[model samples]
Target: MKKVIIAGGTGFIGTYFEKRFNDIGYDVKIISRHPHNIQWDDKKAIVEALEGSELLINLAGKSVNCRYNEKNMKEIMSSRIKTTNILGKCILDCNNPPKVWMNSSTATIYRHAEDRPMTEENGEIGTGFSVDVATNWEKEFFSFNLPKTRKLALRTAIVLGKNGGVIIPYRNLTRFGLGGIQGNGKQKFSWIHIEDLFQIVLFLNNRNDLEGVFNCSSPNPVSNAELMKLLREEMNVKIGLPAPKWMLEIGAAVIRTETELVLKSRWVLPEKLEKEGFIFTYNTLDKTLRNIL
Candidate 1:
């Protein structure tokens, strides 16, 4: 059986990957802060896990769902960089390192663009704390010199799935009639179904020719209004209360998350994936929502 080692494999995405890999007959080893298979601090254990593993995916990062205060911001940046740096070192030390290493990156690295979509080949990188975090994370990931291993930075957008993830909370908001167009509702919301995300990972792993940054988002990015409208329809809600910018700021403060999450216009396009002939299972927002719901 092919062995796969995942850092920070206890989160929603990691857990989903674990199940999928197991179903496909791969041995999944998780390296997390808390011991599931191996602890993050255990250098020997991590090295041992990475040795001879077919694939190594690092999804270990502090969740960006909190207020981007001074402390949280530092942690968010450090967590991603530190984990990725450590994993790179472990892979370097390994006698038989994984052939492919998929590191987590965010589509938020791109600037807020009301016109045109950002792609891997021509995307404009943004500024501010979020962008810095993503930029620094990728810098750390690509800094390693591994001629034998193919490294892929998954510049993922918001991933929607069942039970958990960005979906359930938004679904609940829709159910509660709080799901409304955020801010001016013109921001481009880029997202992908969890299934498609898994497929993309598998696709990258299978194809050795593919490398570097790949935008892991649905090609069909919808406006905020369109996204909320679809969610309202899918949830069978007749009315949704709209939230203005000021209200969003207050709500974000109360919830301990950043309003930039909803307000940013992340119009990302998967040109590389499409050009590579990767077909998404759920391309449209309606279909994706239906599958998740």
Candidate 2:
């Protein structure tokens, strides 16, 4: 049977990938801290998992949905760097390494561009804590010398899916009449449906010629104001109370997450993926919101 290994396979994205792969007849192995999964400390098991596998996906990192305090900052950086380094080492130990390795990277690596969209070929790298983390994470991932394996970094945007990801929070906001435009509502909301994201994974696995960084987002990026209006329309909510920047700051403090998650203008485009003929099922915000809602 075909084999695929997913590191940090307990999270929302990983879980979905596992199911999709399994349903399609791939033998999926998970490396996670959770019981019944291969533990991170077990290098032998990791090496075993990578050997002769068709593909390896590394999503092992701390969630960035928290206040960037001293401890969380250190953890967020270390978690990604350490796991990536370990995987690199294990791949080196493999006699027959996986054909392709897809590492998770964030679209937040690019600057908050409101004027134009950022692509893999022309995107300007941003500075700051989150940007630093993303830069270093990709740096670590590509540092490996796997001559047999193709390496690709998935710079995924906010994923919209049923019962998980940012969709749940957005759905709650719209339901409670708080789905108004966040901040000035000018921030570009770059997003992808979960199904399209999954299909991209399959597409990349087959396209052995493709490597390096690829932005995973819808081509039809919308403004924050437009996003809220569409969400209300789809969800049948008439009155959405817009949260100003000041109110968002307070709410973010109360929620223990950063405002950058919503306020930043992530205008990213999947130029490489589209140029290679990858089609997104949910290309527009309305189509995505309708499916998820």
Candidate 3:
């Protein structure tokens, strides 16, 4: 059986990938903080896992869903950089490293692009804390030189799925009646279906010629207003109370999270993926919400 190593394979995205790979007959070994898996600090074990593996996907990182306080900020950055460094070093130590290594990156690395869609070929790198985290994460991932292992950075956007992801919170909002437009409702919401994301991984792995950065997002990104409207429609919700900027700020504070997750205009496009003949199963917001809801 083909072997695959998924570092930090405990979260929603990682869990989904683990199950998918297992179903397809790959021997999926996990490297995580969990007792059953190879611990992050175990360099020898990690090297052993990566040796002769077909693929290496590092999804280990502190989630950026919480308040970006000083401590959380530090953790968010360190978790990504440290884990990536470990994986890179381990791969280097291996006699036969994984054929391909796809590390997690964020489309938020691009600026708040309201005017045009940010693609891999032509996207402006943004500023601020989240952007810094994304930039540094990619920098660390690319810092290592492993000639035997092909490296690809997955610049993923907001992932939507029924089981666990942004969908749960959005569903709750719609159920309650707060499913209206958020923060003037003009921000571009770029997202991808979890299944499509998984497919992209396989797609990249199959085509060894593809390397470097690929924006993992849907081609047709919708505005915030359109997103809320479509979501409400799908959920059969008739009444939704819009949350203004001030209200969102208050709510974010109460929830101990940041508003950038909702307010930032992430207009990212999968130019390279599409150009390479990759097709998204869930192409539009309507189709995505319909499948998930």
Ranking by TM-score: 3, 2, 1
Greater-lDDT candidate between 1 and 2: 2
Clashes of each: 0, 0, 0
Residue pairs with backbone overlap in model 1: none
The global Cα lDDT (0 to 1) of model 3 is 0.95
The number of the candidate with the highest lDDT is: 3
lDDT of 3 by residue, 56-143 (tens): 9999999899999999999999999999999998888899999999999999999998899999988999999999999999999999
Q: Positional deviation of 166 in candidate 1, in angstroms?
A: 1.1
**Lowest lDDT 10-residue stretch of candidate 2:** 162-171
Error of 3 at 84 (Å): 0.4
* lDDT per residue as tens, model 2, 1-293: 99999999999999998999999999999999998999999999999989999999999999999999999999999999999999999999999999999999999999999999999999999989999999999999988889999999999999988868988888899999999999999999999998899999999999978899999999999999999999999989999999999999999999999999999999999999999999888999998888888
Question: How high a TM-score does candidate 1 get?
Answer: 0.99
Residue 67 C-alpha lDDT in model 3: 96
Candidate 2 is scored at a TM of 0.99
